[model samples]
Target chain A: MKSLFFRTISVTFFLASFSGAALVDDHIHGGDSHLPRPVVVEYSDVESLASGNDDVRLWCESWRFAGEANNLGPWTTVPVECVSYVKTYMTGKRYAFDLEMVSREASRFARSIQMRTDGMDAWVFDIDETLLSNLPYYAEHKYGLEIFNHGLFDKWVEKAVAPPIESSLKLYEEILGYGFKVFLLTGRSEAHRSITVDNLNRAGFRDWERLILRSLDDRKKSATIYKSEKRDELVGEGYRLHGNSGDQWSDLVGSSTSNRSFKLPNSMYYIP
Target chain B: MKSLFFRTISVTFFLASFSGAALVDDHIHGGDSHLPRPVVVEYSDVESLASGNDDVRLWCESWRFAGEANNLGPWTTVPVECVSYVKTYMTGKRYAFDLEMVSREASRFARSIQMRTDGMDAWVFDIDETLLSNLPYYAEHKYGLEIFNHGLFDKWVEKAVAPPIESSLKLYEEILGYGFKVFLLTGRSEAHRSITVDNLNRAGFRDWERLILRSLDDRKKSATIYKSEKRDELVGEGYRLHGNSGDQWSDLVGSSTSNRSFKLPNSMYYIP
Candidate 1:
């Protein structure tokens, strides 16, 4: 039954791909003449957005003059925000933007890890958008304003209607089947524990020896800071993090064990 | 200038805490007459919700009867979905409702590691809510529907409004300053590279030698099956995962090298 279900979902996914391609083509070629086309924001426009914030303005200027011969100051001021904007704006069209270089660099790092691995391995994953697709819920609801809406978000999670990224999900399960312990770390507040677990189970993610979430009453750290601290605690406990996965870079930072990172693509108009 | 800005932000942050606490009390707990009261869901209601799903029902039944004299017919007939639902729900609440026990277990685990450490040191972290405050964004945007609006999300990230858990962030920096390489692992999709980096930078998280995210293009395996792949990858890469922290059991499941696993408090919610 499981095989059959996977097969069914796979087939539907493939079929959907064709339709998706057609839609992309139609839109790219201006098929929807009545709809207002997305305007690409220029460098100038970005600078304008950063006008009030000197830090941002300096960052933008640094980016604009990056690698220029006559530039006086060092490009030490990493305009992380500008990179973010560029990446977000060029989501699906990654190949066409400079941001692809960043991805390529990151991918190269991932590939280096792949080239170096030997023996029984393990990787930790953050739930939400990492292994499963919470974007649909996020898209339908927005960030998570609807999450605190009583049991509404819980219902959505229980339904497990959010679709899976077949390629990624398959990869995750494959890694798990290879005698690796798959750890899931999430910041899905302590308030939605049941629903979060239900969502993962319904989604068919298995063999998770541990599922970690934020505590409701523990008032010690912010989610991101807690994650780093957690890594320290993990090391103190004796677990070797082979590689880490997440939608955010913070997940990959603050650990002495993990050396490689694998990033996925999620530039579909939302920042998180 | 950047140094000055950091100093200012830090000072402001410390001063803001007093005012912030007052504000939180005034706003979050305020609202006696005019504001609509926030609805609180009880544990029983959550159980009822879980019961709606067959998979969750059977899993819960098995869990409830784990050590009972009467065996429940092997409980194998329960659908995988139910098992998963129950698992996620149960584990999600285990920490909050059972923090004392969990902490005791964790401390025991920590003591064991303290004895096991043979002079090597490392750290592992789970991303998502661990290192980043995605909840506010998730809550404010209602799980990513319209509020995940690309532009708006970008603005929020640029601001990096998600406050750091000062104690935790300081601890992480201290670790890094102490010569730790700092590794982070998460289940967030690899698709969130740019914004994740941006968010981290905005939050003042810096100096990690490596950042890892889940690979969207890698067709290695399923997340359920490849539990310890990342840790193995880390070991293969020559980094020892000394301590680990996460809100999920899965994050620490296969980490044999980890000297300690600090399970953060995550009972209110669980994300698959």
Candidate 2:
């Protein structure tokens, strides 16, 4: 039985190695913390054994890539094997760089648009992970290994300590300066209105225009449909969604999508 | 001046290194070929010089990742700096593995669906890079660095020698075995109808219910608009789009999206 298991692992290693997926690592779990910190595995050391986190990390990166591509639909949580990889990514500089790259591109696109003089020109930004950082909350939780619990999450949101995703804040500021009205759209319930408002303000997000959240009736609908309907209402009110930014595809897809859409990186959780 | 140039490269290296984006390599380029072959870089060798293809390769990987995520909008060709990386990716096991991972997940989804006895249940697949590969043609071209020339490309397609994407072929076979009516919906012009049919058959694809291509009237429309119209027509005809697979987001997005959508990796070019 042990030999059979070893052989299976060996086969997996051989297959993944050719794809530049092998790794050498010191298994350094975070000290005095329940969640593991970002672990660095040396990709050049292909001769290293593949029995540990190396193989898991390779597959996790691929999984994360799939997630960001919107190719993996309706996932509930990060794969168990990928929890550490996700933690590493969310905590590491790569996550910040990925966000900055997207924001930079979005900023470039916003600059190119010839905005009309009317106040109707608008840009849409999704709240969580778009404008605010939930890394502190996710780090304390399972880094998306545990199933999402709104009850637990709401408590965190009520604390209103989520920091600004620095890059996205810059994007918001730039778009606002471009004479486009900024509309903050979120899937958060209307019940968290005061806290969400406080959270946005305290996190250095101050703006004109409106903050739209889900009402009691909107709770039962899918994120795509509810958000699409909200966008439809915005268009009905003469708002032109010139630009839309979100961490989830659900926030950017569906009817009345913007002229241009920017998808930020988020592998921790998915909203369908 | 040279020192300043070196300093800028050093700064770029430092920023990218912390993100685990560094490499060492033997600088192997393909022999006597117009398109350079894939170059292998050692990520563990961070202290190595950042002047050559190492820095380019790292950034190229990020660009390709961004492309797959649909964050890079409406690019006509691969970035000039990323031409070699794109060539390597298309020729390497990584691209194949990426395709296999997507197809594997797609197959899993296809198995989970409870198909109806009616012939109206269908799966939509885009031809290029999803059902068939233009890799040989791309390899001989500039690996998507040069501007796309439809005149040159159409001549290549006329030969009808494009091979099947082996993984997607397996997926096609698996879903077909499950009694799902297959639809080959492509952005290819209607002019290539007979050649495409022959090529598909030669490449082991058979018994598809419909091969829908762009007519003269549809040629001027953007791929997103063209595909959405076709999907709407399919839906209007009582066919339920259970699964849709394509190399481009335009093939999967817009109105009448499927119950599930799988995006295959294609960094070579973007149609719209």
Instruction: List chain A TM-scores, every candidate, in order.
Output: 0.52, 0.81
For residues A61-166, could you state the per-residue lDDT of candidate 1 as single tens digits?
Answer: 2232211111111111112344444333222222111222222223323333442244334567766555666555544543322212324545666675555443
Q: Candidate 1: where are CA atoms >4 Å away?
A: A1-120, A141-155, A217-220, A267-272, B1-272
The regions of model 2 sitting more than 4 angstroms off are A1-55, B1-58
lDDT per prediction?
0.40, 0.71
| Interface RMSD, prediction 1 | 27.1
Q: Which run of 10 residues does model 2 chain B get worst, by summed lDDT?
A: B24-33
Candidate 2 residue-wise lDDT, A96-116, digit = tens = 557756775687678878888
Error of 2 at A245 (Å): 1.0
Clashing residue pairs in candidate 2 (N, C-alpha, C atoms within 3 angstroms): B38-B88
For residues B137-211, write the lDDT of model 2, one tens digit per residue: 888888877655556778889899888887788889998999999999887877889999999999899989999
The superposed Cα distance between candidate 1 and the true structure at residue B53, in angstroms, equals 47
| DockQ of every candidate structure | 0.01, 0.17
